[model samples]
Target: MAEDPESGGEKTEDASSRKLGKARDEGQVAKSVEIPSVFVLMAGVAAMYAFAFYFYQNLMGVFQFNYNFQGVPDFTRLEAIRLLYVHTEKILMTCLPVFGAVYLTALLANFAQVGFVVSWKALEPKPSRLDPINGFKQKFTSRAVVEFLKTLIKVGVVCLVCYYAIKGELTEISRLYDNSTGAILLFILKVSFWIFIKVCLIMIVLAFLDYAYQKWKFLEDQKMTKKEVKDETKQTEGDPMVKSRIRQLQHEAARKRMMADVPEADVVVTNPTRLAVALKYDREEMDAPRVLAKGAGPIAANIRKIARENDVPLVEDKELARNLYSHVDIGKEVPVEYYQAVAELLAYVYGLKNK
Candidate 1:
């Protein structure tokens, strides 16, 4: 006897082919962080300070108490007690908005990237967590290199922005010697500008990094090897042998039920070796002709036997028998397509009963 391909020997080849195809099409590592929201929050902080400074200078002017002498003699206290209140108020204003922007941007970035799924499966303790080999593999991967570069670039950009901001404020600091009060106020403005620029640069860089990581992670997670697909299928659906056995058992049970009900049938329609369907009907009790049993192959042979044993009539119209067997179940009404054939079968049975 020829060996079946699905029995065992050829199964490994099927699994291997599936695994290789999936690996070629879908294997990549995911990124681990949110970058964009951090950047937006940083920008928001900068904007807050800029707006606060603008309001402060316009609302409460700097306090200046002066003492004039021939050769630069004495100095009186230039009380900035009111300026303190303005500065604190500005800081608070800047902080609140920055915080709000950070929060909203974080929410949006998180939503856009991973969606709302909050499963703890990834965080569950596994051997992979402690395995140094896995850690080494991840470290050497392209994903790790990209993350390192991203962080380096972010730091570099912020440092460069701070350096230039301070350079621009040098002249304002120098002018403080001649016009002490005005120069002091200008210095404060310059410092605020420098801080704002630094904050903005950091935020923008972080946001860009976040967006890049999100895209990278999405692509990586979506990757799947052929092997992985097959494995997933096996896990979700059971082994082929087990599935086939279950189907066979279910078919056997159905056949036994149909055979038991065959004697109740008014008529058995047969396509000889291929199909058998036994139908039951009553004019007063039934709205339509109902199939009492149906089968193919050996079950069909058994159905014919049951009908003959009970003295129920057997009809052999190939087309009508096949249609009835295909479309109606053992306990259900015949479908519309088989209505005429079933009605004729029922009429023949009734005439025989009356005779």
Candidate 2:
């Protein structure tokens, strides 16, 4: 029942496929950014967890090389540069699995939300987009306010999750000070992994909710006013009045064509006063007699008048006339059942012509 401000009517009609398709071409789709972000975060965390042993080995090797060198390490510029290059390569290798997982997840999540859309139209520059009044209106819209609130809620949720996570591990955190370096590192990893998992789980729920809201909002935005629906119908299907007029013109053209064929007809079968059917047959060119024209009421009168003027024979056969008018279309041969009757009529007309 929401009213369209521009149309001054309720937006009660569902969007037509034409409008929805146009919106999609312009890169308008109901997709939640949170869905991709949450999936990527989860993927990265899972990748890091799966590659934890590899990370540990790499870190240990770097530590031993730097601090447990048996001899004083080479101090030449070349040696220093080589060490830096080796370390950079090791770091990149260590992070590669996590990066790959995040990248693939981001692509898949977006694909799942909106499929694969490459919209150049959305990227086009428009001066209307730079209008200060519209920009100001957009900033203060309900959607913008809702987005602001969502940000605040996410921050609050993350902080609350971190607080609970740390509180649960307070005893273990206190023991970390007395433990070996390896034990402290292990404890930190365990706590961080659990916290990351909890955040991901919460984000998954939020993402789904946000996606639902986005879809609902998209549909609402696509809703059409009654006037819009009517206008679109006219645009796509042509105005009903114009279409009716075209049909009238077509019917007139076809009638004129039918009347023209009456003069060439060898016989005119009539339902006495109401119906008329004109039939013509050529033994050399046609397998059977075809209806040249058929009509009722005013058209029948017209056909009969033309037949009289053209010296065509008028044969009153009520049943045959009704049968031809009802069952046979113009230009189609008479059916097998009517062949004997029509052949007799054709023979009589040809005999009269001989006299």
Candidate 3:
């Protein structure tokens, strides 16, 4: 079991959807820095390879422009500034492909990890982050150690790959001294490209591993303690005690409303002491008799008291009271099966009133 960093309690449960959503809202998500780095590196290498010819042509033009000056021509301040601006513009244009590739790759890599998230809460500054003691502790944390080791391994692997790659090209490199400058430059570019490609392949594997580890670590960090789960449940579903009270209040209010309708009921059928089902019907206004209220136990006793106070007729019928109380709901017309029984009871009450 992992312990919650904040509460120091055992986090025995997986994070709830609400917890994950809240964390996401705060811009906390599983992501590996290595994934973006590797992607950007690969993009830069691919861009450089594709744009090499274009860059060389532009660079050569610039070099020729610098060196192919006619005799000892004018060299004024304005001319110098103009030459600088032109050179700067050409260089920037030559490097545009690599820059664009890096920028787009970075965006894509990050998007792949966490989609598009913008959280002002994440941008907010926290004073706890400025605590020197906390900062010092963080430096020696397990995560920090893992990051440091990962960096070391990456650097070591890249160096070893570069070493083996160059070693394989030693024979070709040795003969470069005897070749033209252009041939030497071409050989160097080829060797560099191959070396970079090998490094990219290695980094790609590492990036996947890192991404998996990061996701696992993020889930672990988000794990909740049992108490926290209950507390969060209370927050979202309302506290059980409070909910019970609300339900009780609702039942009482409905009962009072039902009691108010007792004075208007044609009759109330009772199981004598156990059940009470108050009914109402009007020949001109109602299609059939309807249960105005029904209750058991204390509510049944209360209904009987209200019926007596309102002078509503009370008809004691064990089987009919049980059926009406069990089957009929308040404000609903009695079913056709009970229509004959209800009509007889209402007729008996009307006869009593006529007397």
User: TM-score of each candidate?
Assistant: 0.64, 0.89, 0.91
Order of models, best lDDT first:
2, 3, 1
The order of the candidates by TM-score, greatest first, is 3, 2, 1
Clashing pairs in 3: none
Poorest stretch of ten by lDDT in candidate 1: 6-15
Candidate 1 matches the true fold with a TM-score of 0.64
> Could you list the CA RMSD of all candidates, in the order they appear?
9.1, 2.7, 2.5
Clashing pairs in 2: none
Candidate no. 3 TM-score: 0.91
For all candidates in order, the CA lDDT equals 0.67, 0.91, 0.90
The digit string of per-residue lDDT tens for model 3 on 1-355 reads 6566766579978999999999999999999999999999999899989988887777677767888777886889999999889999998998899999999999999999999999899999999999999999999977899999999989999999999999998888888889865566677778888988999999999999999999999998898898899999999999999999999999889988988898889898998999999999987888989899999999899999999998998999999999999888899999999988987888899899993
Question: How many clashes would you count in candidate 2?
Answer: 0
User: Candidate 2, 315: how far from true, in Å?
Assistant: 1.2
Error of 2 at 248 (Å): 2.0
lDDT of 3 at 119: 87
Off by over 4 Å in 3: 1-8, 63-86
lDDT for predicted candidate 3 compared with the true structure: 0.90
